[model samples]
Structure formats: structure tokens, C-alpha cells
Target: MKGAALDTPHIAFVGAGNMASSIIGGLIASGHSATCITAADPFPASLERLRKSAPVAVYNDNAEAARSADIVILAVKPQIMAEATDSIAAVVRSNNAVVISIAAGVTIASMQARLGPEAAIVRCMPNTPALLQHGASGLFGNDNCSAQQRDFAQRVLSAVGITCWVDSEQELDAITALSGSGPAYFFLFIEAMIDAGQALGLNADIATKLALQTSLGASQMALQSDVDLAELRRRVTSPGGTTECAVQSFEQSGLRKIVATAMHAAADRAAEMAREMG
Candidate 1:
């Protein structure tokens, strides 16, 4: 570790895209020296952007970056993970580095095939909110991963936001449906709310601001309060009140069923991607 503490591990990112940049920025902001971080991307523009934020070493070759790192984060797309792993597999194995992947739909089994069975692997599903340091990540480790590696993976992810470990690989599919695709679900709801607000004569800017702030406040309240979400909603919904009327309308329209179906569809798609990519 060039710029980190004596025990801090040198982290290398195999992709220098938005997610990778988010993690790197979070890490640097949290006191991890930029010199201790390395980013590898095929695109010059990507590396340029990362450099503008943090003066981390940039590499065009994944293997070269992986060769000297203690932890290698596979931030590339699931479709390209196989190719990326192939390039750095030997270096990672020889160095006994922990491999943490944020690539959606790429399973531990799929990665093991390329990185070798002995490789310590942790697969995580993180949403776009990570860029804003408000993300929630779901992590799952393979049998080869040690406690230390798991902890290291958690620490790396915690830079951006909250992290939780799931016991089984299958649970990752459900996690993917929940938090992985959860941001888009909230965005869709916000969009609808804004459109309705505008329909009611509010300007677009006012509608958007109101919708966004309400969403943020509601989320913050849910996080800070001990009360259950249902109860919290109930607290705002008095009998025969406007809130109750709106809630009734949502229920009458089968909002709950629609949400459940959409989540199930997302989970099914996650599993399908694993099968296809595996």
C-alpha cells in the first residue's frame, strides 16, 4: 500500500466507470490515499475522469493492475467479466488476492470457472445510488473466501454505503430484485408523482422538487425511525382523510400486486441472466 496505512490493502478496480469512480471517490474521501488505488479501463476517457477526481494509478491492462493489488474489484459489466477475469486470473491467483465483483448477474460459480476454483470470490449487487453514497449493497461469498477477505470486501463496499451479507448465492437473485433494481422502482414512482403534480397545475420544476424532497424525507424517516414502515404510513393516513383517500385509490388500483409482480419479474430476469452468463 503506497499511500494507505501499513495494514490497508492496495485496491485495484478492473473498470473505471461510474460505479468504480464512486467507490474510489468514497475511499479517497475517507482517507485512503489515491496512490493506494489503481484503476484499469480500456477507455482513455474513463481513466481521464477518474484521474480528475483522484490521482490513482491508471492502467489500460487489467492484468498489470491486478498483478500488484491485494484486492481486485471487478467492476466491469457481467457480459465482459469472463474476458476481464481471464486477463487477470493468473496474477490474482498467484498473489492470493481477494476478488470482489459488483457486476450484476455474474455468479460466483461463473467467475470460479474463469478465475479457478481456489480463487476467493465475493459477488455484490449495488445500485446506481452508490454514486451518491446512499447505496445498499448485497454481498455473497464463495466457500473459498476467508473471513478476512469477506471483511475486506465489506469495508471496500461500505465506502459508498451500507452492506449486508447473504448466506446463499440464490438469495443474491432476490437481493438483485430488491436493492439492485430498487432505485429504478423509486424513480418510476417519483416520475409518476411529478407528472400527477404537474397535471394538477404545478410547474415542472416545483413538481419535481416536491416529489424528490418527499421521497428523500420519507426514506430518511424510515431509516431513522424504529417504527415499521406500514405503521409510519398509517400514522400519516387518518380515517377518511386525504391521505387515506389517496391510499385507498392506490390499493383500489392494485398497486401492491403490480409491485409484487414487477419485483418477481426482476428476480426471474436476474436468475435468467445468471444461467445465460454462467
Candidate 2:
């Protein structure tokens, strides 16, 4: 990718939490100058840590961070979004900068209502894998956002990982379930696999290492291979083999049904949070 398209844009992070740190790391890794970005957090320790890694400026006030930024990112917790936005709303609205929010359960409309009708809002949901630059982000732009604004948002988000754009804001809740909360499900599976391996006589350390690597290799293959997962699995599971034994156990345990149920519950909870926020 050409560096010109990603030149510093006077970006500001309203909350320098984990997600914000991931994005900041991605931006710097993607050729953006640390001097172009600024972050704000109330905690002195967080600010000190951010300052050590990047040449970016740090502020204790959200409004100070947003004052001159071309793109302002709100990375605070959803429950505190109102308070955070309220602190910087005046400056952000006055600047008319494009605002990208990673706060789960906060809608673009809610941000717009707080920032102003003219605010160009993009709502994003990125999972925890973002910390490793393997994130899956779902982006939805409000009507007021221009194509350039959307592209800019996509560029910034793509720095962290893969990005998908959604047409309807409502789909963000589903994205939250599939991508935002998806890592935990996979981690849970890995934990169970390691435990089962240990129960089968492997040492704890060996079981953990084997389970993690297996999961990684399988996921990489599933992503890179053109063949379907079912086909791949079928090729591996020879008749009456150990793999088949495990497959049968999983089938008998209703693993697929359990996963579906869990994902549905996550989606339902996201929807409930959205409704409650209103």
C-alpha cells in the first residue's frame, strides 16, 4: 500500500484503553507518524505508557484531544459514553470532524444526537483479536458521512485487521455477537481442548501448547484453503480413527447446537443493550 494515502490525519483517541492502544499500534505500524496522533486518558499510568511507545501527544482532557483532530475516535466504555461525549461534544461538534466510535452498544444515532446532527459518525465493533492485529471489524456509517469519510474510517480500521462494511446499523449487534464476542467462544473451546488433552495423559504445558497451535493451524488452513471446512474435516476423519472418535463425541454432545445457542444469546444481549441505551 502507498504511504501517501495513509499520511497523518491529526487523529485523536478520546479514551486510551486497550482497543485504542491496539489502533494506535496499528496506525504507527502502518506507516502513520506517531506525531500525527494524540490520545487522552484520565489515568496517569496509561498516559505514561502510551507516551513511551509512540511520539504521540497525550492529554488528560478529551476535549483537548478532539480540538484540532481531523478524525476523533471514541473508545470509552458504552456505559460511560454519554459522559465522555458530553465532555468533548462542544469541540468535536464545532470541528465537524469525522467521528469513529468503537464503543459497543452505542449507536451512530446516539453519537450524532450527542455530537450534533451534522457530525459524521461511523460506528465500529472490533473484537479483542485486534490486540494482535488479527481483528475483524464491522463498520456502519451514518447518512451524513461522505464517501471520503467512510474510506478514511475503513483505512484506519484496516490498519488493525480485516474490515467489513454494513448497510444497516442494526446489523452491528449481529456483528458484535459474531466478531466482538467471537474470540471468547474460540478461547473457551481452546480451554476445553487443553483440559481434555490433559485428562488424556498429556502434561498441562504440552496440552496447552498443542491445543493453541492446532487451533491456529486449523484456522489458518480454513481461511487460506479454497475447500470447504466440511470437506477438509471429512478428509481428516478416517473411519474409526481418533479424530472420528472425537468428532463423534462432539456430535453426541450437540456442540454445534450449543455454539448456535451461545451466539444467539450474545446477539440477543447486544440487542437488549441497544434498546436499553435508548
Candidate 1 TM-score, true structure as reference = 0.96
Candidate 2 ranges beyond 4 A from true positions: 1-7
Q: How close is candidate 2 to the true structure, as a TM-score?
A: 0.94
**After best superposition, candidate 1 residue 1: deviation in angstroms?**
14
After TM-score superposition, the amount by which residue 265's alpha carbon in candidate 2 deviates from its true location, in angstroms, is: 0.3
lDDT for each residue of candidate 2 in 57-150, tens digit (9 for 90 to 100) = 9999999987778788999988889988788788776766788999888877787788888888999999989988999999999988878778
Q: What is the C-alpha lDDT of each candidate?
A: 0.90, 0.87
The TM-scores of all predictions, comma-separated, are 0.96, 0.94
Q: Estimate, for each residue in 178-270, the C-alpha lDDT of model 1 and write its tens digit.
A: 999999999999999999999999999999999999999998999999999999999999999999999999999999999999999999999
Residue 254 displacement (Å), model 2: 1.8
Pairs that collide, model 2: none
The weakest ten consecutive residues by lDDT in model 1 span 1-10
